[model samples]
Target chain A: MAAAWHVRGLVLALLLAAVEGRAEPPEEESPWFVPDHAALQLAGSIGLLSAGPGWGFLRDGVDAELLLGWAPPAVAGEDFLTVTLKGQWHPFRPAWRGWTLRPLTVGLLLSYTFGDAYFVGLPDRYPDGYYWFKTALRPALLLGAGAGRPVPALGLRLQGYAELVATDYRLLHFLQSPATAGTGLFSLALGVRVRF
Target chain B: MDGPLRFAVLGDIQLFLDDGADAVEDLRRRDVDFVVQLGDLTEYGSAQEYAWVAELFDRLPVPSFAVLGNHDVLGTGADIYRRTFGPPFLSFQHAGSRFVLFDSNSREYAFPGNVPDLEALGEALAPEPGVDHRFTFSHVPPWNGDFDAALTGPLEQLQAERGVSASFHAHLHQFESEVRRGVPYFVADSLEHRNYLVVAVDGPVVRVERVFY
Candidate 1:
C-alpha cells in the first residue's frame, strides 16, 4: 500500500512539474528527447494506476508513450511492475467552444512485466514449443475518445479520455467461449493527458 | 463394506466458470466421498480468477483437489496455484485407496520433462500395506503433445509397474478412455460439456461412470 501511494505522489509531482515547465519561455529548437506531454491512467490491466511521458507527432494526431505501471500486493494480490510502449492515432479532431474533441482514437500497446515469475522464454525446465504464449509480455488493443481544452494562461492543454482495452488473453477467451467470456472482452481505463 | 467408495472427477473449467458452478452443484447432490478437478481453472491465471475458483471450491460439501494445468502456470500463476491449492504434487489415502495428484503440463515448462516428476511419483506410488487401489490424477495425459514426449513411454511403464488402477487427466476438453501399457487412462470432459465422471471402488474392483448434468 505504501508503495502504491508513493507512486501516486510521484505521478502528481511529475504532472505538476510538467505543467510548471510549460510556463517558461519556449526553448529555441528543443531537443528531440524532451517530452511534449504526460499521462496518468487508472486500471485497464496494466495496474491500479500508471503514469508516463508521451510524445506527439503527425500534426498532433499521433501519440506515443512510455509508461511505468505498478500494482501493490495489497490491491493486486501480488506486486507487479510493468513497462509499456503504447502508440495511438486520432484521425479526427473537432473544435467546439474552445475545446478539441477527438471522437475516435485507436491504439496498441505491448507491456513487459519485470519479475522472475513472468518469463519471456521457456525456462530450462521445459523443451521448446511447450507453451505458445509468453507470460511476461502482453499485447493489447485500445479504442477510445478524448476531449481537451487549451488553458492559454498556463500554456497547456488538459485532456480527459476513456479507453476500452482488449488484451490478448481476453480476446482469445472471448473468441473461444463467446457465451461465457464475451462480457469480459474489454476492460475500461480512464486517464488524463496533459500537453505542453 | 461401505458399498463402494465413490468419488467425482471433473475436467478443465477454463472460461466456463458458470458451467463449472452448475457441475459443482450437481456434484454436491451426488453424495460422493470427494472430488478431483482436472485443471485449467482459469482462462488467464489471474489472481482474481483464482479467488473466484477457490470460492466456488469452498462451497463444495466434500473435500476437493485441483490439478495444475498449462493455463494455470501463466505469469505468476504457478505461485498463485501453490498458494490457492497447496502443492501441485500431492498424495493422500482415502477409503483404502491411494490418490496421487501431480503436475503434468510438461509443455508449459517447455518440456524439460520433469513436470510430472516421475521420481516423486515413484515415491507416492510406492505400495502401502493396507492400500487396496491406486489412482493418479494430472492435467495433461501422456498421449497429448503438451505432455513431455520423451517421458511418455517411461511414465506409462512406471504406472503399469506400480499397478495403477486408473490414470485420470483433463486438457483435451473431451472424454476418452483407453488402456496404455496394461493401465487404464481416462480423460474427463471439460466442465463446458456439462459432464463429470464418478468412480466407485470396491476392494480390487473399480467402476467408472460418466454423469451428465
Candidate 2:
C-alpha cells in the first residue's frame, strides 16, 4: 500500500516538473521530444490508475501519449503492470466564456501487460493456431470528450475528461454472447489532463 | 439387476452465461444422479465470471464436477478455479461406478507432460471391491493437438487395459463420438448448441443419448 502511494507521488512530481519546464517557449520551437501535456487517468482496462506525458501534433488537434499503469493487488486481486501507447484525434474544439470544450475525441490504444502469467506467443506445447488471441497484449478503442480552460497563473491548461473504453476481450465476448455481455462492452474512465 | 445409473454431461459454457443457465434449468428437470461439466467454464477467467458460473452450478439438483480448460487458466484463473471448485483432478464413486475427472489441458501448462498425471490416474483406476465400471473425463480429447502427444497412446492403452467403459471430453464446441481400440469416447457439444449427453450405465453396458433442448 505504501509503495502504491509512493509511485503515485512520484508520477505527480514528474508531471509538475514537465509542466513547469514548458513555460520557456512554444512547443513547435522546442525540441520534438519535449512533451506538451501530461495526463492521469483512472480505470479504462489499462489499470486502476495510469499516468504519462503526451505530445501534440497538427496544431494541437492530434495527441499521442505513453502511459505507465498499475493495478494494486488489494483492489484487482492481483498486481497488474501495463504500458500503453495511445493516439487520439480531437476534431472540434469550441471555446465559450474562456472555456474550450472538445466534445468529440476518438482514439485507440495498445496495452501490454508485464507478467509471466500472460503470453504474447504460444508456448511450444501446442501446434500453431491453438488459440487465436494473445493474453499479454490488449487493444482497445476510446471515445471521449474534454472541457478545459487556460490558467495563466499556473502556466497550464487544465482539462477534465471522461472516456468510454471498449477492449478486445469485451468486444469479442459481446459478439459471441450478446445477451450476457452486451451492456458490459464499454467501461468508463475518468481523467484530468494538464497541457503546458 | 440394480437398474441403470444415470448421469449428465455438458460442454463448454465460455462467455455464454444465459445458455449455461438455460441448460441448468433443463437439467434440473431430469433424474440424473450427478453432473459433469467439460470445462472452459469462463471466457476471460475473471473472478466475477468464475463466481457467476459457480453460482449457476450450485443451482443444479445433484452433485457436480468441473474439469479445468485452457481458457480457465488465463491470468489468475487457475487460482480461482482451485478456490472455487477444488483441484482439477478428482475421483469419486457413485452407485457402482468409479468416475475420474482430470486435467487434460496439457498445452495450457506449457506441456509440462504431467498435466493429466498418469500416475494419479493409474492409482485412481485400480479395481475396488464394489466398483463395477470406470469412466474418465477431461477438457481436451487425447487425439487433439492440445493434448500432450507422448501421453496419448499410453493413456488410451491404459484405459483400454483397465476395461474402462467410456471417456468423455469437450472443447471443440461440437458433438463427436467414436470408438478407439475397445473404449468409447464421447465429446459433448457446447451449451450454446442447447444439447447435452445423458449416459446410462447398466451393469457392464453403457448407453449414451444426445438430447437436444
RMSD of each: 5.7, 4.8
Scored by TM-score, the top model is: 2
The reply for model 2, stretches above 4 Å from the true place, is A1-29, A58-60, A74-78, A95-99, A149-153, B1-5, B15-21, B42-64, B161-163, B201-205
Q: lDDT tens string, model 1, A88-128?
A: 99999999999999999999999887666667987876667
| lDDT (tens digit, per residue) of candidate 1 on B1-213 | 559899999999887877887888898889699999989998768775687678778889999999998889887788789888999999999888999999998877668769789999999999889898999999999999788889999899999999999999999998999999999999999988899999999778899999999
> For this target, which candidate reaches the highest DockQ against the unseen true structure?
2
Quality of candidate 1 docking, DockQ = 0.28
Query: What DockQ do the predictions score, one after another?
Result: 0.28, 0.36
- Candidate lDDT scores, in order, read 0.85, 0.86
Candidate 2, residues B104-155, lDDT tens digits: the string is 9988877787878999999999988999899999999999878998999989
Worst 10 residues of 2 chain A by lDDT: A1-10
Model 1 clash pairs are A125-B112, A126-B109, A126-B110, A126-B111, A126-B112, A127-B110, A127-B111, A127-B112
